[model samples]
Target: MKFSAERATLLKALAHIQSVAEKRNTIPILANVLIHAADGQLSLKATDMEIEVVEVIPATIKREGATTAPAAVLYEIVRKLPDNVLVELDQADGDTPLQLRADRYATRLNVLSVDDFPSMGAGELPCRFKLNAGVLRSLIDRTRFAISTEETRYYLNGIFFHAADADGVPLLRAVATDGHRLARVETDLPEGAAEMPGVIIPRKTVAELRKLIDEAPEEIEVALSETRVQFTAGSIMLTSKLIDGTFPEYDRVIPRNNNRILRVGKKDFSDAVARVAAISQERSRPVKLTLEPGLLTLSASSPEQGVAKEELDDNRISYDAESLEIGFQARYLNDITDQVEKEVEFAFSDSAAPTIVRDVDSPSALYVLMPMRV
Candidate 1:
């Protein structure tokens, strides 16, 4: 479309939307970004069929028109241009190729008919509410790391968002897990989200939204149905279909009465896990947790290598019951504790039962990790 926009603004918008377009496409038009202009505003849209991103920017719409061009090439060229340059798109010379002009630098990119681009389905979006950017960021960062990359369990491939009863009070929760470990974090239910159905946000969208949250948009408008979900923040909007499958019932696996408690400094625990787990095999880095009256012991060993034992002071570590030795994938334990902001508490039912780690203050955020038989 014929429009003029700030070089930096154009570059940012292009970078955001173009990521949704896959590098290699089975269809030619799938690699091109659809450009639309009207009312002095330009919109850039790119889709890989499953996900679609639309970015709008303020521009001088000299002529209202629509066209498509390679998303990657245009993004790179615009990104490399001089700072503060005003980019102008012109199609008035009776040439189908749109001329990108910025000061002395210019390029004529062959444009395709916008009609061939896939049309994004914008359903009747009603449910929406504003949540703090800080809250959204917290929900994603804490849980996204545990999302499964395994293609077999497609249902666990994204973070689960839904309303649930936490501490006997209504709350909105986000959960993600592979088979080894799981993260469950919840926040107070936002207004207009009381009846929102649970949806599994795809992994790609989880990552993309993390980048956009830096804008600190006022309202994170969310809309979802049984099959699809959409999020609108700042001048960008993302839409994607929900994963069509049933997520495993994770609550039953959460150890409810894990009475054995050990309070340890998060940083110290993470460091010990990192050092000891290195010597163990990648597949079975089962770091054993041995709790005594006043000490917390972390030990690991391998047949190929020797063994290691680290004793740390945990003032509250009092386990009168039989000495419990719970084994866990040290890396998984580290992932759950690395992002935690403060003191970390590990609770266990037994050496064989599931072990849970939680913040000493934040009851809403909990991690359930399966134990290994060492």
Candidate 2:
């Protein structure tokens, strides 16, 4: 089989697909990328079993054939070739060794048998729909920071996505938490999404797919099966297996009937938290917030370092009692507010109960921070 293609086109396809190939794998085939040349299009596919990506590009195919070669090496070689140089790929005797050439740069890369490559087969996707790429990007961007990295509680390691009520109507929701902080965001439920099962997409898969979706076209087609989900956008496709575990029912954990409410500028809260957290020790980095009437005071102290307090002027704290003090991981609070587009509303009952924060007019997204003992 032989194919000739512009260096830039081949490099782009390889770059798109090679990111999904595992750098080091126990099985060598997992590190190899499958190259298929047919018609006037060329396809490069790679997978790490859990996540797979395939990129398609237009090429001049003189002979139709498929072969597997080291994904990293091929990507690096093509990246170094001249921009418009044409690359030609062919097999010497249709055997295990493949010939690769592009002008002065040529190499014979050892090929893995195509029979050993594992391709995921679609299993009758019960639920499918179209999601706007921009909306999907917003959901991921605003909440990914709160996803748990603790492997022990694997159930909380990804965004918990489901259908829920938003202002008494049906809506699609995504929630992520790491015990200390929680991020919840929602969008109008798209048609045909009510019956879909809630899936916990792993963090690694989410990050990899994020890059693909960033450059994807405006609309993306999503198909979800019992165990896996596939996104087809433009000339690329990504398939990933959902994490197999029960996501914690976080509804009960969210406090209800909180009486204290404080409305303040999102920027002010974030900056105050950031400055106070700087002096906090690494291990128990807690910032104490004192709310009383119209005053909001942030303070933090470390055993080796003295206490520091910063007063925020002209804020709205609807409490008149002795200051209601709440301690929290300053970084968590800052992360939740950093994405806020406008003012923030902080809800609380007492210092011990969890506090919920949200944009003034947008209830679609909510953030919860569990209080820490300072």
The best candidate in terms of TM-score:
1
| Pairs that collide, model 2 | none
Candidate 1 lDDT over 210-245, as tens digits, reads 888888476688887877888888789889878888
The estimated TM-scores of all candidates read 0.94, 0.93
Off by over 4 Å in 2: 93-96, 281-283, 315-322
In order, candidate lDDTs are 0.85, 0.84
lDDT of 1: 0.85
Give the Cα RMSD of candidate 2. Answer: 2.1
TM-score for predicted model 2 compared with the true structure: 0.93
lDDT of 2: 0.84
